[model samples]
Target: MSDTARTIGVVGAGSIGATVCADLVLHGFRVVLVDRDPAALERARRVVAEAVRFGPMLRPGLPRVGAAEALAGVTTYTALEALGGCEFVVENVSEEWETKRAVYRELDRVLPAGVGIGVNTSSIGIGRLAAETGRPELVVGIHFMNPAYLKEAVEVMRGAETSEACMAYVMGLLADLGKEGIVVGDFPGFVSNRISHLFFNEAARLVEEEGVEPAVIDQIFKRCFGHRMGPLETADLIGLDTVLLTLDSLHESYRDDRFKASAHLRALVADGRLGRKTGAGFHAYGLPAGGTGAAQG
Candidate 1:
């Protein structure tokens, strides 16, 4: 697709949303990012700029672009109507049903007919979200991990009514961004979160019940399992609040106690220790949260 024809909309300005915006910009796609919070938009912008500027240092194969040029490629807006002109949109709103439902309703009204939407969710089913719009065939689940620019693959969920054409289009788009799509069913939590959240919750339980040091628990997983990042470390990176929210969602959808969140996890959010974003959660951090088009939803 022509760069002009490929203008994409990204909704939400949280960790994942900002990171996705950067990945799009890095791959030379102009973006329109929307969020209710102005502060988040600003933060997301910084994220894109920094991710672009320093991207080449981490991976020599990455294209190096100045912050100004990279930042110039994206537009951040508070109004959802700004997305009307986008050819495709990636929805990364909060994991709450009502919040996502409201966004889908607006997206249905704003986007042109036949424009596909990528629902970047944790546990919500693609079918449920697609049902909110008149065009179920165009909605698909596109779950991206945090710090998206570094990820080489994404979980692509195909809903009951998701069209083959839409699937092809999204796969092509991911390829353009230097990533692959692993298609899966419309099951709640799909594959990643349904399984990963268990590790996070159980890790927290171990900490609370057994009094195991968080670092030691994480070390065991990393050393013994050959995992890149441990459960506790990942929880902090994803923001403990987000992990807990996702765990709650899985529990509600499955009604399984296995998805039940640890009480310690709940208490951390209540105490305002939200992980790296808040400078503390499972571990304390030294840096402040900052990134922006003007970015974070």
Candidate 2:
């Protein structure tokens, strides 16, 4: 596909999707971001605007759009029809198989023949989703990390029936978007998540089993492992619900002991102490002047 002719449609404008769309727009690709929630679309626009302001430094010569017109190249829509003309469609919906399958079925109805469709699912089976799409050749997994702008790795998962041509196109697209796309098998918890989850799951176990304080464990990991952000802090950024959902899906799919959802993490989510989004999880954060104390849970 020619750079000038590239147009990507993104379904769901949450953090990861929004970040991906912004990065794509910066690369001069026309984008249409779809979301059901008006508030979410607005929030994504603000995120894009901030990234645009820091442009060129992030990607040389990329658009440095102002707040008002930050989302100009990208269009927002609530209906799937608006995505009809896009060359590639990326679905960044919730991590539920049913939700993702529903989205793909709808996308299959809308996308033109031969157009590429990518799922940003972390732990779901790409083969199953590909079969669900009916157009198995066009469907592939392009699992991007949170804070997509900063993360250079994108896991490219192909189903058993996925064509070599489709894989080539996806890798080329990833390269064009300034990312390194590594091909992997159709398994639960593709490369990044498989490794990253070890950090999070073990961290949770340490806190629960060894009587380790959350703060102390976080500090130890950060200092000892030379990690910039500890597992809990990363979880805070990733949203507690997402972390739980990923764990549940991986555990169910693989039935692996290592993928067991941590009891403490599940409790935190159940009590609505959803990390940074809720202003507290393992730690408390405050708004500029006056934010409340250790957020209720």
Candidate 3:
């Protein structure tokens, strides 16, 4: 399909989903963003607007479109059926098996035959996700990083039955979004989360067990290791709840203790401190402004 004809459907209007929708629309692709929560949809609308106005500063090569023109290509809906006309679908629901399974089942029934479904999961296996859908050969993993628009690379994984045609289409779509797809084999957690989660979990443990401050751990990684963001900071940005969920999935799949969720992380999530979204996690933020919160680390 041609770029102008591509109307992408994005499920779940959370940070990642909203960011992806913004990036797609910024690049001149019509997008249908789906979410069950009205509040989330509203937040996504604001995110897209702000990204359209200010994102060019960070990504200078992006198409220079006004907020109105960028938003003109976006359609937000709470119904899954609205995605029927989309040429491709990208699912970014919570990282849970049942949630993803249900979304894929609905997409299988609604989306036309041969349309590819990209599962943007952090830890779940693409093979299992594909198994839950009727069109297994069209389901692939397109794991975009947090803040999808700013990131220039994405991890793509193919299920056992994913067809070559589907892979080609997904790769071409990523190119259109100005991203490099690092293809990897189907595995629980894939490459990025498998290794990154290890670092995040270990950092959480240090805080809980050794009484190390969150800032200290992050500072060590940033200053000593020459890393852009520390594990704790990265976990906060990714949402502590998501980090815990990923750890649980990794531990279950690998049967290893290294992937165990940290006690501190669990406590924070139980307290409703879901990082930047909730205004608190490892760090604190001020009240949410314009439906978005600033990360204060």
Candidate 4:
């Protein structure tokens, strides 16, 4: 498809979804951003505006695109039916099986036949997601990092039945967005989340079981281990609820005790402390509006 003719549909208008939409718009691709919540849709609009206005300052080599022109390319909708015109769909709904299953089913019915659906999940298996869509070969995982515009690499997972043609198309799409697809085999959590969540879960255990301070743990990792962000801080950035959900999915998929969710994490989630999005998770973000910050989960 020609660049001017490509319209991408992004399901869900949370942090990841909004970031992806903004990135697409900046790259001059028409985008359809969908969400059920009016508040989230509004937030997504604001996020896109902010990204267009300030993103270039943060990322040195971004295209010199006008904010108004970029914003004009995006259309926000409350219904999935609005996505019927899109050539490709990127699903970023919550990580729960039932929620994802419902979205995939609707996407399968609403989107035109032959259009690929990218499952942007953290822990759920790509094979399971493909099965839910009834188009195993067309459904592939494209795990774009948080703040998708700034990230240069995406973890692409090929489902058991995913075709080589599907993989090539997705990799080409990523290249168009100025991202490299680090393709890997389909697995629960795949590579990044599988290893990263282990570190996060252990850090939570340390804080809960051993009474280690969150800051201290993060400091040790950053200063001693030469890491950029500590696991707890990273969890905060990812949202505690999302972290818990991914952990639950990992435990279920692996049937392992070590992947179990931590008590401290559960307590924080139960109390509405959901990390950076919630204004408080392992630490506080100064009480943002909408419970659990801006995260969809």
Runs in model 3 lying further than 4 Å from the true structure: 1-5, 289-297
Backbone collisions counted per model: 18, 0, 0, 3
Error of 3 at 283 (Å): 0.9
Residue-by-residue lDDT tens digits, candidate 1, 1-297: 135636899999887898899889888888999999999999888888878866666655666767887788889999989998888999999889999999999999989998999999999999999999999999999999877887889999999999999999999999998889999999989999888999999999999999989999889998999998889888888888788889988999999999999999999999999887777888766664552222211
The estimated TM-scores of all candidates read: 0.95, 0.88, 0.95, 0.93
> What's the lDDT of the predicted structure labeled candidate 1?
0.87
lDDT of 2 at 242: 82
Candidate 2 vs 4: which has more TM-score: 4
lDDT of 4: 0.85
Q: Could you tell me which residue pairs clash in candidate 3?
A: none
lDDT tens digits, residues 83-183, model 2? Answer: 99898898998889898888888888888889878889878888898887768988888998766766677989988888888899999988887888988
Q: List residue ranges in candidate 2 displaced over 4 A.
A: 1-5, 54-69, 286-297
Q: Which predicted model would earn the best lDDT? A: 1
TM-score of 2: 0.88
lDDT of 3 at 207: 88
Candidate 3: tens digits of C-alpha lDDT, residues 81-152: 999899999999988888888988888988988788999999999888888778899999999887787788
Q: Report the C-alpha displacement of residue 242, candidate 1, in angstroms.
A: 1.5
Instruction: Name the runs in model 4 displaced over 4 angstroms.
Output: 1-5, 287-297
